[model samples]
Target: MRRMPTRAKVEMAAYGASAAALAVVPSMEVLPAHAAAAAISGGSLWWLYRKAKTGDFARTIRSAQRLLGPVTGGVVYAAAAAAPGRPWWEIAVALGWGGVMAAWLPVTRSTWTPPAETGGPGYPPGFTGLVMRLWDDAEVAPGTWLEDIEQTVSPEHPDFTADVVALAGKPVPRLSDVDIAAAFGVPTACVTLADKPGHGPGRLRLTVAPTRRRGGGIEEVWAEVVARPGGAIPGSKIVHVKTFPAQGDLPARGMVLAEVEPGEVARINHEQLCSAFGVKAEELRLVAQSRGREALVTLYESAPLKGARRATRELLTLDAYGRYTIGTAHDGTDAKVHMQSAAGTFHGFLVGVTGSGKTVALALMCAAWALAGLANWVTSARPDAQMTAVGRHVDRQGAGAIFTWWMLKAAIALMDIRGRINGEVGHDFSGHSPYPGLVLVLDEFNSLVGDEALGDEIAQMTDVLAREGRKFGIGIVFAGQSLNLSKLGGEASLRDQVQGGIGVVLRIASASGGIAARQATGGLAGDVDIAEIPDRFNASMSLMDRMHGTVDDVPGETTQGVGHTVTGSEAVMMRTLYVHLPKDGSPDGLGEIFPEGGGINTLTEREIQELTELGLWHDWTMPPPSAGGDSGDAMPAFTGVEAGGGIGTLAPPPVAVKAKKATVKEQVLAVVDREMTAKEIRGLVDAAAGTVRNALSDLVTDGKLRQVDHGVYAPVHAPADV
Candidate 1:
């Protein structure tokens, strides 16, 4: 009774419990044996679990030696019990030999060994041997998983590693600790599961012990698992041993300190870290607090981003901080992305050519933000029917009937004043703005940039906003066709900062998309693979949606809007949510009132009435064609007409066969055979408001037309004589 040690007590319990189990297994007769066998197995598991909790072992051998005694000895004891007529001395000798072999094996020079085990928590029987023999380059075979498996573009990793480690009945292992399991006899366990969600299971790993060799390890062994007969590989983890510098760059904690030589810190920068680890830099996590002065870089591999969905209302919940999910990453992760969701107002530039669905994408993004309760404003310096539709649901839809440059100029001016007000209030301004989450959407940004005078003012506004307004919760959405960061109105600092700022940039397919990608993302456009996006949205809309409706008659494909999303230095493939264009036909009688259909209607009935009250209506009207009886039969107004003109009822000269009308683009390109004012082109083509300007810009951009001076455009292939 003199204070038996805890280790001795555990050993006694294990020996007594295992012996009882063998004694019952041979009795095989009936209920008593069954009860006894179950008790032995359950009791052994409970006892081992408690013993594991009792003490920690630095090496696997120490712990395995303990379990090795019980497990291997139990097998021998069972064999002896099963031998019907074996002599008592023979049985004793067999048990004693097994114990002696177990005790002496560790002292012999050998490799990581496995201990025989029945079963324990989290780990199955034979798990140690399985991991020891087959932990590397193993995959979960197809049939082992559920049959109704949701096969994705990528496979999934299993979550079985933690359980295996837990079942190993050892204390959790540290990075430097040889802690794979006490039974596997090795000190490491690493499992790389399926990157795709619903990942299947597999274990991959290799242990490397470094020696004096430079850039070469001393000894390396592959921990490959062999599948059971007719069984699939059970993947639980990937394992590898990391080598760290022995000195200061020496790894104290889990991280290996990359060399911090002069300028070497930056030279071994984020990309270098990713390259060293062989993964996307975004997958790596930098340790914030390292024990040593040297920084330790940590790489964390989570589920790869994937299974992007369409725009949903749930994704529209953004805080005043301007955080919003425009869409998900193509890699199938749970990460939500916000454009320029920083502390204050910054700029996000979106570039895509016409038919690239850029406008629709921008519109939907803005709508998502607005629905999220973020105070968003819009401005289109180059106002058009499409842009008008995009902004219809937002704050810039004619508050006080304001539109175009009025809104654009006012937004910029307000940002300046707000910046001033913010300085008076405080720089951070209590976490957000007075009107928090103010997103000024600059639609058709290149038009503003195209203006020699307004471009400078806009650039000046951008510099200030991108500088101070972001602190005041003022963010800007810069959208245009083929927007180039370097060509953003000669502001080098502005371009540099924005290109490197905290906003998501989307580069869709375009003529100048490559330029924007190179300038803004500093990456190749070829990587985007726009062609992969199928033309999936060709289905017809309702007749109403096609005619008087503002919805796109030819709806954009779900995949067509796919682009490259650039968040700082990293770029990932992304697909913007499909935009359901709103129906925004002009109100009935609106065209009649406008007459010219460009600016506000000069001949509105209200205006006409007011003019009549002021006696100006009479002046504007033509005196009702002179009600004085047309002054003697209207002075024979048709005198020059031939007598045959009177026979208009005679088939109207075969109805003067009409020709099919051509598109505004065709007309513009043909007429640009000679120099002409935009006004002349408008009169000739009679296009809609903003249509001529868009066409002109397109013609210029496409090398179809050259602007000789303001408003005058001549065909690029026009004859010199003309």
Candidate 2:
């Protein structure tokens, strides 16, 4: 026969010696014969049980053999202590026999020692060995271990299953560093750290599956995949699982849902979660919720409108409530602006630096208003550059635009009061036939408000229109580069009125501009950080790659018309649709929108008569082109009252008369509401520091200004509206 194994030999030796001790040790009588035999047997059996419980046995040891492990020596040594008659050599031999059996019988081997209550979960077929290996490798807890682990399968996803491990120490963060995907033979996306209710913070759960379980498709849904009605948002799931799609342009589209107390959600760090998930910090977003126990976390993808979106007539068409689609939001939904709600009308402000798509955004509004049967009058400081397309939709004007705007407001006010008095209408404009809504578009509006000679008059008129024109179906849309109230005629009330209606802040030119934009619309738009918005979608991406020395940078598409739109209490980052994209050979989208004599809205005789009575009426005609044919071509004009102080002109046919430029001293006085240095005044006004200082000195001597501190002067009188 083949040689017996070493373990078998050791077992034979241990059993033979123990059997001899039980049979012969009692006869030798360190104690009474019967008592000696019983003591030996009981002591030997206890040793065997201890070995088995601690995972020391070879697993092939029979209970009969295991019980005879020569522990008779230990029993006799104790009996000798009481007897005091036993030989020392005999006791020594008995003790040596007990030692040999203890060392030899429980073959030194490491067997799987699962927890006491629930041994362990049953791993998937062919995965038991790997799970055991990972358990030893992970060292989840040295002292406190997993208990009551159960194999669970998701009801919705047949291929998705997990081992719900119940443990005392939290293993969520540690498990993130572990190669869980390798242990379970699944794609990394399918492995998620999750929580279960009633488990307490001490325990964590994880879900995993085999790659084959997903049928070899990369975009497989995991056990945590939530079935939303339209995939618009990840609804709450009070289970321990992270929902992530396996494939996307980005690394992964994942959502983490946690059931937390009302205030605890604020403490959850999204950036830390992003780090754990191996995504950039900006990718994660904590969705705002009202009172709730669940906190939803998700990632924002790149904006969808990466290229020029052609303007279509259908998109320009306004709804019955005077809302029209301007572009797409970051969430891939349509972005709209409310020109007039059913309850009341609204004014709007659009702000961005040059080349930031300020004009493109304005063009969208103009086209929409034209389609909605509103009379839109377009005017601009830099009129010839980007105002051409918008001009094609309505009558264009320059210096006389403000005068015309005030006259139109008066006409609408007359019409509104007349209708209300006659019981022909309610308090609000009806947005119908003869008294159609009107929009006074003021492009580069900052230039008008910043003009020292006429800024106050324009601001006062604008404030009046903003306050009273809404009830009469009249609105104003101001477009500019900044939202500085001081630059906007220093009227905080005007800023408040424009913001109450609609506000769009595109890529800001300066940090201060961004702060002003964000602060101004904070109530309406929530917490959109316009200052952090990139100039282009790919701008940061390219910069980052170059900084890391891996980029051969290519030109990227602009974030033109990309900004936040605030209406009522909601705001969304959006990209405005292109109204005039020259690269696409559709330079003039307004032509397609109008398709007629500029779609101009002429004044009704009734309204024109009201203007005549107010001394604001001029002949509605275009004057003959001048001999030089360069500058004196009369633009379309309507009868309007002429205001004073270079604000308007007296003409049979209302002609464009340029506004007066302020002198250095007047400019200096206009800006010095607070203490400012000569250098600061020179920076604001296009004048030398010496000239600014001289003007400041003259004003201080005249009592119109005062020196508050060294090199600092403030206005002596409160700034008044001209």
Q: What's the TM-score of each model vs. the native?
A: 0.37, 0.50
Off by over 4 Å in 1: 1-308, 319-322, 339-343, 381-386, 397-404, 415-433, 452-454, 485-492, 496-516, 520-558, 582-722
Q: Kindly provide the TM-score of model 2 when superposed on the true structure, using C-alpha atoms.
A: 0.50
* Model 1 lDDT tens row, 1-722: 13434544455555555554454455345566555545654565566676677666444445455455545654555565556754565445554554465335443233333334424223323323344233221322211211111111111211122221211223322223232223223323321211223332232222222211121121111112211121111111112223221222212122333222233221113333333333443321222111122333333233112123555555545545555555554433323445453433345667665555666666666655555445566666544566566544555442111133233333444443455556766755343435445667766666665554235445555545555555556666677654544444445555554554333344334323224355433232212212112223223344565588666655533444555555544444455654454336443221211112222212224323532442323321121121123236431211222344421111111111123478778878877668788888888776884998898988899888888788888878665556
**Per-residue lDDT for 198 in model 1?**
39
Clashing pairs in 2: 195-240, 616-640, 616-641, 618-639
Candidate with maximal TM-score: 2
Each prediction's Cα lDDT score? 0.43, 0.54
Q: Provide backbone clash counts, one per model.
A: 32, 4
Q: Give the alpha carbon lDDT tens digit for every residue of 1-722 in model 2.
A: 23445556656566457545543454354557656556666767776777678764555265435454434444654454445444555545554665666555542321224334354544433333445446545554333333333222211232333344534454434465246665545577656556655665456555553433433211233113322222212343333434343233222223444454344322223233333333343221222221244544444333344555667778778766567888866545677777664346557878778778877787777777777777776666543545664565564444343444444444444544345433564345664544667777766666666654345545556665666676667677777775434533435555456665666877766454224555443232333333234565545453567689986566566777776777643446667877654534356556765534555765567765765675445532222112232455444333343443222232222223454589998888778767777778888987887887788888889898878778877777543321
